[model samples]
Target: MPDDTAKPERKRQARGEKRIEELLDAAAEVFAERGYKAAGTNEIARRAGASPGTLYQFFQNKEAIAEALMARYVVRLRAAHGEAFDPAVAELPLEEMLDRIIDPVVAFDRANPGFYALLADPALSPELASAKKPAQKLMFQRLDQILERRAPDLPAEQRTRTAEVAVHLFRGLLPLIMTATEAELPVLVAETKEVLFSYLSPRIDLEATPQHNRRTLTPEEAARKAAHIAMRSNVTTDDVLTAIHEARAEHVRAVENVLDRDHPREDRR
Candidate 1:
C-alpha cells in the first residue's frame, strides 16, 4: 500500500493553509478598498471562495483576520527593509540612508498599494493600532543599529531619538507620496530629504562629537539635554525630551526584566 490516508491528510492540510492565505489576501484587499468598517467577513469569505465557518477555523472574527494580515505585512516589509541594507550599501554617505530606507518602502507601496491604504485608514481599532507601534519600533531599531555602526561616536539616546523621528517622519510623508502625481515624486523625495536632513543632521553631529563619547545618558540627563536642545531650536523640544525619557525608561526596564528572569521584554516590533 502507498499509505493513501497519509497522502490525503497531507493534501488536506496544505489546502487548508492555502485557503487561509487566500482569505487573508482577500481580506487585506477588501479592507483597503471598502475601509475596515465597511468590509465584512462574509465578503472576504466570498472573495476567497470559502465559508464563514472556514474563516472561523483559522480566525476568530474579522478583527483577528485583520490583525493577522497586518502582522504578515509587517513581517514582509521588515524583511524587505533588511534585505535592502547591506553593509556596503549602508557605508555610503548620510544622505544615502534616506534613500536606503525610503526606496524600499516606496517600492513596497507601489507593489502593494492596498497595505499602505489600509494603514492610512482611520478606522483601525485600538488593538491593531497598538500592534503597529512595535512594528514601527523594530524598523526604527534596525535603522538605529545601522546608524550606530556608521557613527560609532553617537550617544545612544541621540541615536535612538533620531531613529524614532526618522521613522515617523517617513511614515507621515507616505500618504503624500501615495497621492502624488507622476511628475511630483522627485520633488516630494527631494523635499522630504531636505526636511529630514535639516532636523536630523545636526543631531548626528552631536552624536559624532567626541564629548558625547558614546555615553548612555541616564533618563534625567537625556530629558534635560533634549529640553536644552529643544529650547535652542525652532521646533518643539518638549516632545523630544518626553520621547527620550520614555525610551530610556523602557530600556532600563527591559534590561532589569531580563536580569531578573521574570517577564521577558516583549520585542514585538
Candidate 2:
C-alpha cells in the first residue's frame, strides 16, 4: 500500500524470520559494495554484527546466503510487479500510471542493490541463474500487457517491441540511479520519468499529436541523441555498438519499425 505492494506485513514477522532479514540486509549491503567473487561469509557476518557461528546457523556458505537473498528478491519483486501492472492502473492518467509502476522499480533498485550484483556474478549455480530468467520474462509479459491496453491501436508486434525496449531501459537506468547523490537523486529520478514519458507518449498517449508528441532530430542530432542515451545507460559507446553489431539485422529492423511509426506523421505535417 506504501507504493511498494505489501513489502512488509508478511513473510517476515516471526523473530527468526526477522533475524534472517537482518542478515540479508547486511549481505545486501556487502554484495553491493563488493562483487560476489570478492565477498566472504565472514565479512557478511561481521556486517550483520553476528558471530560466524550464528551466521552459519542459518546459511551454509556465502553462496547459500546469496541464493536466499535472490529468492527473497524474486518474491518481493513479483508482488510489487503485480500491482504495478494491474489492469486498474490502465485507467489512470499516463503520468500517474508511470509513477505507480516506476516507484516500485526504483524502490527495488535502491533497496536491493545486491540483486544487480548477483545478476552479473559468474559463480551463481545453474539453479540460481535459471531463477532469474523467469522473473525477467514475467516483468516483460506484464509490461507488454499494460502496453496492449494503453496503446490499443498499436500493432501487436510494435507493442511487444516497445515493451522490450522499455524493459531494457529500466535495466540500464537502475545502475545509474543507484549512484546518484541525495541531492542529485530527485533530479535524476525526474529525468528518468521524463525519458519514459517521451519514449512512450508518442505511441500510447492518445491525447498527443504528431506536431507536439516529440521533436524531430536531424541526422547529426540523432547521432548525438544516441550518444546521450548510451551515456545515461552507463555503457560505453563502443560496447553499445558492439552489441548492436552482434544483432545487426534485428537492431536495424527495430530501428526501422520505430522510424516508420513515429516519422511518417511528422512528414505529413
Best by TM-score: 2
Q: Whole-model Cα lDDT per candidate?
A: 0.64, 0.67
Clashing pairs in 1: 134-269
User: Candidate 1 regions off by >4 Å?
Assistant: 117-123, 205-269
The parts of candidate 2 lying over 4 Å away from their true place are 1-18, 120-123, 210-213, 216-235, 238-249, 252-269
TM-score of each: 0.69, 0.72
The Cα error of candidate 2 at residue 239, in Å, is 7.0
TM-score: model 2 vs. ground truth: 0.72
Model 2 global lDDT (CA atoms, 0 to 1): 0.67
True-vs-predicted CA distance for residue 220, candidate 2, Å: 13
What is the C-alpha lDDT profile of model 1 across 116-164, one tens digit per residue? 6566565678997776665556667777887787767888887877676
